[model samples]
Target: MSLLKEKILQVASDLFQTRGINSTGVDTIVAVAGTTKMTLYKHFHSKEGLIIEVLNEHYRHFHAWLSERLDRKKPAERLQKLFDFIEEWVSSPDFHGMAFLKASAEFPDASSPIHELSNTHSQQFRRYLAELAADAGIADAEGLALQLSLLIEGAMQAEQIKRGSGAIVYAKKAANILIKSSLR
Candidate 1:
């Protein structure tokens, strides 16, 4: 990516994550990025285009972070590691729920690109969980993955609503029960 484009994306991602998609305008993005609207348009074509790129960037960063944390763990431990990471994440001061979930809420129209991208991001994460479950020798990996995915989503919402309470701790306990039951 071009240096200017990268800067724009970083600035936009920070603003969008902190503020929101609809609340942060192009003018603010340009101003913070130290680039003009014309330059942003030249690089991204439009604000929606920029938003899509920002979403993509967010997914990339999220996936990289998750992978780095879980890759070294054994297949059976991966799920636990995932929940551990989430627990720490929700406890952190910077926690603000899932960015994709926030984006989906902002763009409720199912046909919208932002909405579709957010859905794709979620499905991809679920697929990853399913793969891990299968590798761990679970018989119903798909079902287990779906259940775990629900727990993760529920924890995110609960944390958001409760402002980073013990939702993840409970979620992790539920996940452990699910994993034990599934293995049996």
Candidate 2:
């Protein structure tokens, strides 16, 4: 990405995550990016296009972060690391709610490209969780994955709505119990 495009993407991603997709305006993004509407359109074509790019960026960065945290750990230790990753994530000062979750809510139309991108990211996340569960020798890997995904999502929401409420801590305990019972 060019410097201008990178700046626009960073500003838009931050604004969208902090404010919201629907509430944020192209003008504001351009202003923050220190660019013009023409430049934004030159890069992204339209706001929806920009939104999709932002979602893609989030997906890439998140997967990279997750891979770093989980890839080196032993299979049995992966779940523990997963919980630790999420706890630290939710506590970070830059912590914002899940971008996919926010996008899906803001663009509820099932047929919309924005919604599709968000849903795809979510399904990919669930699949990644199932992979982790399988690696851990869980008896019902898919079931365990679903349980863990929901727990993580709920914990994130709790942190967004009730910061410092120990939601992630509770989530980790519940996750351990679920993992223990699911072990083959």
Candidate 3:
């Protein structure tokens, strides 16, 4: 990406994540990006287009971060590492709940591109969890993945709404019990 485009994306992503997709306008993005509407349109056809790009960028960043943390760990260890990462993530000052969830909330129509993109991001995460479960020799890998994914999503919402880190800690404990039972 060009410098201008990169700046636009950065500013837009930050604003969208902090403020909201519907709440943040093109003018504000351009102003923050230090660019013009023309430049933004040149890079992204419209605000929806820019939002799709932002969602993709967010997924890329998240996948990279997750891969780095879980790559070297054993399959069994990866499950625990995931919760550890989530704890750190929810506890961070920059944490502002799941961007994908926010986008889904803003665009509730399943046919909407923004909503689909958000769903895609979520499904990808669930698939990753499934892969990890399979690698760990779990018999019902997909089932376990679904369960874990629910726990993760719930914990994220709880942390954001409750403004505390206890959700993740409880989630981790629940996950441990689930894993142990599944292994036997």
Candidate 4:
């Protein structure tokens, strides 16, 4: 990416997360990004196009962070590491709930590209979990993946409401039970 494009994305991403996607305008992005509207248009074409790139870029960073938290140890340990990292993430001060969930809430149109990208990001994560479960010799890796996905989502929501108090404890315990049962 060009220097100008990267700057625009960074500014827009911070503004979007802090304010909101729908609330943040192209003009504001350009102002914070220290670029002209023409430059942004030349690179992203439109606000929607910029939003798509911002989301796609967020996914790349999120995936890299999640990957770093996992190891190639026993399959169950790999998942447990993921669960622990999630708890850490939720507890972090920077976490403002799931970014995709926030984006989806802002763009409720199911047919929209933003919504589709949000869902795709989630499905990809679930598939990654399923891969872990399958490697652990679980009989129904898909089922386990869904179960874990729900737990993670629920925990995020709970953290939003409860401000990160005790949600992870229950989530971690439930994950252990779910993973244990799947191995049997």
lDDT of 1 by residue, 60-111 (tens): 8878887888888987788768899878767777777788989999999999
lDDT of 4 by residue, 48-149 (tens): 999999988887887788777675466657876777888877788767677787888888899999999889988998998899888778889999999999
Writing each residue's lDDT as its tens digit, candidate 3 over 5-69 gives: 99999999999978888899999999998989999999998899999998899889878887888
How would you order the candidates by TM-score, starting with the best? Answer: 2, 3, 1, 4
Off by over 4 Å in 3: none
lDDT of 2: 0.89
Write down the lDDT that model 3 would get: 0.89
TM-score per candidate, chains pooled: 0.93, 0.96, 0.95, 0.91
- Name every residue pair that clashes in candidate 2: none
Candidate 4 deviant stretches above 4 angstroms: 72-76
Instruction: Report the poorest 10 consecutive residues by lDDT, candidate 1.
Output: 88-97
Candidates 2 and 3, the one with greater lDDT: 2
Per-candidate Cα RMSD to the true structure, in Å, reads: 1.4, 1.0, 1.2, 1.7
Tens-digit lDDT track of model 2 for 17-89: 8999999999999999898999999999789999999999988888888888888899877976899998887
Model 3 residue 107 lDDT score:
99
Which residue pairs show collisions in model 3? none
In model 2, state the lDDT of residue 168.
91
Answer with 1 or 2, whichever has the higher TM-score: 2
Cα deviation of 171 in candidate 3 (Å)? 0.7
